[model samples]
Target: MQIYKVGGAVRDRLLERPISEVDWVVVGASAEELLAQGFRPVGADFPVFLHPKTGEEYALARTERKSGRGYGGFTFHASPEVTLEEDLLRRDLTINAMAEDAGGRLIDPCQGQRDLQEKWLRHVSPAFAEDPLRVLRVARFAARYAPLGFRIAPETLALMRQLAESGELQALTAERSWKEISRALMEPRPDVFIRTLHDCGALRELLPEVDALFGVPQPAAHHPEIDTGEHVLAVLRQCAEHAQPLAVRWACLLHDLGKGMTPAEEWPRHIAHERKGLKPIRAVNTRCKAPRDCQELALLVGEYHSHGHRALELRPSTLLELLQCFDVYRRPQRFEEFIAACEMDARGRLGLEQRDYPQAGYLRGAAAAVRAVTVQPLLERGLEGAALGEALKRERLRALETYKAEALGEPSDPPETPRP
Candidate 1:
C-alpha cells in the first residue's frame, strides 16, 4: 500500500502556513488488510484507522456518492481499486483535493495549485453541491484566507447561492451549524463569514435574527454607520482586533438584534432596544445550543449593554445593581468580557472607531471597589440572616458610591449611622 499526505496538511504546506495536523490516505489497501496489520479501525461511515505508533488518522482512499440530502446522505466505496485521484475528487474545494507522496511528488489533478496561486476558492467538481455544509466551509475558508486576498470563484459562488435558494441549508443540525458558525467567528475577519452567508442567502435561513438587522436604521449621531447590520459587523471586527474570546465576540455579533425590531416610526431611535433584544438573543442561543457562558454573557449584554456604555453617568445605586446583575464578585472574568463586548459596540461605528471608551475602566473600577468590601466585618458585628445580607450589600454600595464620588471629584456621602 502507498500512503500519501492529503487535505489541509498539503494545502497549508503549499501556502507556507504552520501545519497543525497531518492526515494520510492509504491507496490500494483494504480495511481488512489494515486491521490485520494491527491498525485500529475508527471510521463509522467509511474506512479510517489509527497508526499504531504515530496515532495520526489514516483513511483509505475512497469515493463517495450522493444518496439523499444534507451532509449525512452519502455512500462511500473504499477498496484496493480506489485511485488517489478518485478520493481527491470527493473533496469540497480544489485546494483541499491535492495530495503529496512520500517522495515529495505533488499530485494536482484538480488544478488546486493554480487556484491557490491565483487566490481563488473554487469547487473541485459538480459533486460539491451534494453537501450543504460546503457552503459554510467555503465561507469559513474565505474568512481564513481573506487576509491573503483570496476570493471565491464566481461560478462557485453562484453554486452556493443556488444551494441557499434551494432551502437545503435548513437540513443541517444545530450542533453542526453551530460548529461552523463558532469557528467562523474566531477567524480574523469574521464579518466576512456573515457577509458571505448573507450574499449566498444562507444568513436568512440560518440566522434570521441577525439577517433582520441588515436594513434597520440607527441614529446617525451615535452610529455614523446608520445601518444596524453595518454596526454589528464593525463590532465583530473590533472584537477580532482586540483578540477577545469567543463569548465576547458572540455577544458583539448578537447584541444589537433588538434594534431591528424597533418601530420604524421611531426611525433612527431604538429607545429600549437593549431590553427588547433579550428575546431574539435567547432565541438564537436556544437554537444554537450555545454554551452557558456564551448564552449568559450574550443575554446580559443584550439586556444591559447600554448601561455599560453610559456607566460613568449612572447613579451609584444603578451601578451597584449592574454589578449585582453580572455577579462580578464571583465571576470577575465574565464581567471583563462584558466590558470588552460593550467597548466593541461603542467603538464599532463610522468615525468612532478610534474614540475612547472610558465606561469600561469606570465600571471595572466600581466592581473592584465593591469586591474589596468584606462581609466578615458586618458578620463580626453580630449581623445575621437577612440583616447580614443587607449589611454586606449596604457596605458594598457604600464603597462603590465613594469610588464613584472620587472618580467625579465630588464629596462622598456621610457614613450611615449603625442601626440598633
Candidate 2:
C-alpha cells in the first residue's frame, strides 16, 4: 500500500508556497482498511478520509465513470488494483497531474515539470474534455500564471471550445462554478478569466452580460479605441496589475458594463454617460444572478463622473457626495481603491498622450481632492473625545478651500495633539 501526496499540494510545493491542504492518495486502501487505520471515512462517490493526527484529507486512488450529467455525476472505483499513474493521467492539467510518494519521490509521468518550467498550462490527457469543469479550471490557471507569461495549449483551448459548444459546460454545479470563478476573479489578471472564457465561447454560456460587451460601440471622443470590450480590457489590465483590493478591482473591471447595451445620444459636448450607463448594468446584474454586493460595487464605479483629475472647483457638497459613495463601499481603504481604479479608467482612455490639456496634472489634482474629502485627518486639537474629530474636519475643510487653486489638493493638516 502506498500513500502519495497529490494535486495542489505538490503544485504549491513547487511554487514555494506553504501547503495549507494535503491530499494523500492511498493506493491500496479499501474503505475498511482506511477505517482501521483511524482515518475518518467519508464519501459515496469517492473514498476519502480525514487523517487521524493531522486532520488533513486523504482520498483513495480511484477510477470514475460519468454516470450522470454535469460535473458531480461521477461513479468511483476505489479498488486495490487501480494504479496511481492511471489516476493522475485522468486529471485536467499537467501541472496538477503529479504525485509524491511518502519518501518524497515525485512521479511525474506526464512531463508536468517540463510544462511548469516552460510556464505552459496543458491538459493531462485528451479525456480532459470529458468534464465541463476543466473549461473553467483552465481559465483560472490562465489567471494564475498570466503574470508569468504562460500560455494555454492551442489544441487544449480548441478542445475546450468544442466542449463548451457541445453544451456540457452548463452541467457544472453552482458551487463549483462559483468557487473557480471567485478564485479566478481574485487572480492577478482577471482579464484572463474573462478573455479565455470569451475566446473559448464559455463566456456567453456562463455570463452573457460580459459577453454582450463584445463589439458594443462607445462614444468616439471618450474612446478612440474600438469597442466597449477593448476599453474594458485595457482598464481591467490596470486594475489587475494594481494593488487595490479584490472587490475594488472587480468594480473597476465591471464599471463600464452599463454602457454596452444602452443607447447613447450625445449633445455636442456632454453625454451624462455615467447616469445613462447605470441602468443597463443594474438591469443586467439583477437579471443575470449577480450578487447584490457585486451589483452595488459596479454601480459605484459607473456612477462616478470625476476621473480623480483637476480639483478645478469641487465644492464641499461634491466632496461629500464622493465620501458618501466611499462610505457605502464597505472597506477600510475604499476611497484609495476607488481613486486608484478611477485613475486607471481615466488614464487608460485612448490617446492619453493626446489629451487637450496635460492629463498628469489633472490626475494628481483629482487624487488630492478625492483623498482630502474621503480621508479626514486622523486627529483634532484641544483635548480628546469627539471634539478632536470636529477639529480635524474643520481643518480639512479649511485646507480644501485654501488649496482649491493648487495643482494638487491641500497637504494633510497635522494632528492637533503631539506632546514631547
Candidate 3:
C-alpha cells in the first residue's frame, strides 16, 4: 500500500506554484484494506478515501473504461493490482499525470516533465478523447497557464475539435459545463479560455450566444476593436486586469449579447440593443444555472450597460430609475460589482484600455447620495403609508439631482416643496 502525492500537487510544485490542496494515489491497495486502516470512503463512483487525520483525499490507483455518454459515462476498476503508470495514463493532461513518491522523487512515465518544461499542455494518451469534460478542462488549463506562455499542443487541440464535433459536448450537463466556465472566468487570462473553446468549436455548442458575436460588426468609432466578439474578450481581459470578482466578470461576458442579435442592415448601430440583449442573457443564465447574484448582475448589465456608459447625460429621474433597477439601496455590493463590469466594458475597446471611466464613480456617488436620504426623515415629518413612499421617492430624486449637479459643476435645482 504505497501512497504517492499526485496530480495537481505534483504539477504545481514542479512549476513553482502555490499548492492549494494535496491528493494521494495509493497503488497496491484495496478499498477494504484502506477502510480497515481508518480511511473514510468518500467517492461514490470510484474508490476514493479521506485520511482520518489530514482529511486530504486518497484515491486508489484505478483505470476507467468509457461505458456510455457524457463525462459521467465511465466504469472504474480499482484494486490492489492497479499500477501507478496505468493510472497516470488515464489522466487528461500530461502535466497532471505525473506524481511524486513519498520520498519526494518525481515520477514521469508520460514525459510530463518534458512537456512542462517545453510549456505544452499535451494529452497523456489518445484515450483523452473519451471524456468530453477534458475539452473544457484543457481550455481552463490554457487560461491558467497562458501567462506562463503555455499553449495546448496542436494534436491535443485536434482531439478537442473532434470531441466538439462528436455531439459529445451537447451531452455535458449544465452543472458540469458551468463548473468549468465559472472556474475559467476566474483565471488570469479568461479571454483565452473563450478563444480556445471557440478555436476548437466548443463555444458554439456550449455558448452559441457568445459564439455568434465573433463576426458581428460594431461601430469602429466607439469600438476600435470593431468585432463584437473581440470586444467581449477585451472586456474579460480588463476585468482580469482589475481583479474584479466573479459576478462582475460574468456580467461583462454577457453584457454584449444583444449586439450579436443586431441586424447586419443595422450594421454598426445597435439602437436598442440593451433591450434586445435581455432575452439571450436570461437564456444563458438559465442554461448555465448561474448563481442568483451572477444571473441578476448579468441581466442588469445586459439591459442597462449603455445607461451606465451614459451616466453623465441621463436625467435625474432616469438615474434614479437605474438605481432602483439595481436595488442599490438593498444590495450596495452588487451595485459596486455592476459598476466594475461597466468600467471594464468601457475600457475594453481597442486603444481605450487606459481611458478613464468616470461613470462608475458617478453612479457610486449617486447611490451614496440617495442612501444618505432616509425614510426616517419623512416618517418624522408625520408622513405615512402611500404618502410616505411617495415622499421618500421625492427625497431620493432630489438627492440624486443635487449629486449630479455637483458632479457636473452645475448650479443645483431648487428642492421641490414638500406636499401638504
TM-score of each: 0.96, 0.76, 0.96
Q: Pick the candidate with the highest lDDT.
A: 3
Candidate 2 per-residue lDDT, tens place, 1-420, comes to: 888999989987987767878887889768888888898876654588899999988887887777776787677777888999988988899989999987889899999988888988899877788889999999998987888888999989999999889899888766678778767877788878889999999988887767877877765666667477777777666666655566565666667655554654532222455676677667655554556566666777677734334324357546545654556225535555556666667655666522332333443444464446533334322335687656555655555555454643454642111000
Q: Write the per-residue lDDT of candidate 3 for residues 162-260, one digit (tens) a residue.
A: 999999998999999999999999999999999999999999999999999998988776787889999999999999999999999999999989888
**For residue 170, what is the lDDT in candidate 1?**
84
User: What is the descending lDDT order?
Assistant: 3, 1, 2
Q: By descending TM-score, how would the candidates be arranged?
A: 3, 1, 2
RMSD of 1: 5.0
- Stretches off by above 4 angstroms in model 1 are 410-420
* Pairs in clash, predicted candidate 3: none
Report every candidate's CA lDDT. Answer: 0.89, 0.70, 0.91
Candidate 2 lDDT for residue 27: 90
Give a tens-digit lDDT track for model 1, residues 1-420. Answer: 999999999999999999999999999988889889889988666699999888999999999998977878898889999999999999999999999999989999999999999999999998888889999999999988999999999999998998898888888888999999999999999999999998898899899999999988876666778898988888888988889999999999999888889988997888888888899999999999989999999999888887887787788899999999899889999999999998888878887787777777788899999999988878779999999988898888889879987886753643211100
